[model samples]
Target: MQETLACFKAYDVRGQVPEQLNEDIVRRIGRAYAEAIRPGNVVVGHDIRLTSESLKQALIDGLREQGVDVTDIGLCGTEEIYFATAHLGVGGGIVVTASHNPKDYNGLKFVREASKPISGDSGLREIQHLAERNVFEATAKRGGYQTADLLGDYVAHLLSYVDITSLKPLRIVCNAGNGGAGRVIDALEPHLPFTFITQNHEADGHFPNGVPNPLLVENRSPTTALLQSSNADFGIAWDGDFDRCFFFDAAGNFIEGYYIVGLLAGAFIEKNGPQRVVHDPRLTWNTIAVVEGAGGEAVQSKTGHAFIKEKMREADAIYGGEMSAHHYFRDFAYCDSGMIPWLLVAELMAQRNQSLAEMIAARAAMFPCSGEINRKVEDPRALMRAVEAYYAQGCTHIAHVDGLSIEFDDWRFNLRSSNTEPVVRLNVETRGDVEKMKQKTEELLRFIDG
Candidate 1:
């Protein structure tokens, strides 16, 4: 029998549960992964989603059938799987998570040795095709399965990224949105000097407050409200799997992820001295300026974790950041992490004797950006082409790195269509001209709508 795996996305497997992604389909995927990559030992973990456990077990069954040993790091965030894959020297790893998707959706993210991503052009396509064919050779010996607790080691590693003694006794607000991040926070609380005001700190699969996506404006209210009322230094929030983290200042303002990228880039250069940093093309001006000013090289890559990580390795970049809140570290085998960014930011604040707002305000003012605006169109490709044609004149530069990025002397914009939907995403920035940035954003939207 053959099946069409609609859950297989360009980067990983994601779909609505039970229908598009169920235990049977996941089992087939596991067998396919084992056959395609032929990893002898694999690490697996799951998020707080209700169906993740069962699906993980089904996947393990498939791996075992193909004689692949499994190490179940039960109930962990996606980064933990990445860490364990590289730390424990496993052949590969997978995490069962939908990562801020709605209640009924679940998925899997895969990585090969050294925590390298297995995306479309990588081994993912082969796995998808093999799973669709649904044929696997039976092995004489079944693989072993065991559980490991690497929390202490993981937390220690997280702490290694920052100088703990340099961190001040700052009060920070952390909202996990009832996801896996809170667990890691709890583990790190005893080790750090800062006081953590935690919200929705428990791991709840039901997600009563809603899906744990900090990108949604509504999801941020709880964290921002708590931060303002409690007089905390700053606030941080995470999505379901806690892979990407969002930041809020003491004034209860959501710091745009673009500025954070520049901040992190500068932090890396300040610490490591003129190293390369990777950034997505969606928003580039501020990052380039910050990197060059700090005597570092700024490298641009297509907007995705796989691409960023691959580019980081090629350039031996010390750090990589995307405006979507994903922060990648070279020390972590070039994988993205939600926990590391906040810690580094805290250390940066302490070292500079500044607040989070104080550090970001200068850069945000220098590069005012129209945070990614999305519009659904009947044909996103056509809309992209139309936007490109409309803006081609008076543009000093144009590139289709990940999308249609058009640049002028004082302002620039990147317009790209979504991979999975008929929606186009637009991002605009200017050379410290907020009004111009706003005007151009509105103009681009009107054109896109037309």
Candidate 2:
């Protein structure tokens, strides 16, 4: 058997199919998870990957073999599994999905009660060790599986988050990119007062257009073109498993998730009145400014889903956002969702009577940013240390929250290595000076490459 610890990632279990993440490994993980958490009942869901069903069945068999009751929520998104776990008050949950990876890749995301994520520190290491040893002690009494359709309740809960009754009947374009978002939107459209123009809405495992990751400029073109042709109020797209969603303006301009983070933070503060908000350190100025201006506390965290969720719980933050498009909520057990951000943004637009572009554009000039750039590097940490040394002498502010972040009088930049890939991610922002931002970005790139 392939070692399971090699496949266990910072936030979830993911690897190449059949080799690193086969049926036996998934089954072992399920049994290990059951034993570790020892929940009376566990909720299970799977995405639209080709191998998802088989892997899910293997996991379920393992759980049942260990005498743990399983509540199967078949054909659901990642967030839906979170909802099922939190709503049912189960001991924990597991979602079978590779989440925007190629069709051949598949993985699992495990969570404890209340849909809390299991990171390397939070019980995942224990599960990994157990699975690696294949030492799950099965109970003599076998457990049974039960089926429940929680989609209706899930939709109702999402609807309750927004004032749908007061929403305007705006024309919106949604590109599911042939993922699992189509089913949820199909159920949601009937309940809301909005016109939806959907493209690639079919849930196809083949993923004809790509993996549906809207972060890539190439993957966003279809959704932008659809928005332009339809002249819709906005366009939304999701990743393969519909865990994180992205947005486009009425004029087919793709808005950065950082801007949306500020927008959502402002909205939440407006309603809830000056609560704490958690933001990752990859990009921080915009979120910090918005949260502080709204009379809310801005807490900076390391860049990862598990870290963000833990910080949210600790600070009791009303919301948390990552520039990578992950948005977590206090009400949603601090789990990220692809569906919730759009709904909240739509409701905000309806309530404010402003275009999505207009509202987000107001902050664009205030916090000009170079966005995020990734580069292949041989020595990421050495490069980061070199940059830090270069700036530490003259820098007024510096932090190593996730990676290296340095601040001068007029400009700030963050250079961090990706946990999953061997690439250094760079994000630079200036005090409304585009030229300075570009110059600093170029200078930093040259230094790193040199």
Report the lDDT tens digits of candidate 1 across residue range 367-401: 89999999999988777788889889988999999
Q: What is the lDDT of residue 357 in candidate 1?
A: 92
Instruction: Estimate the lDDT of model 2.
Output: 0.90
Worst 10 residues of 1 by lDDT: 379-388
Cα lDDT tens digits, model 2, 128-168, are 88888897684988888899999999999889889878799
Candidate 2 lDDT at 285 equals 86
**Model 1 regions more than 4 Å off:** none
TM-score of each: 0.99, 0.98
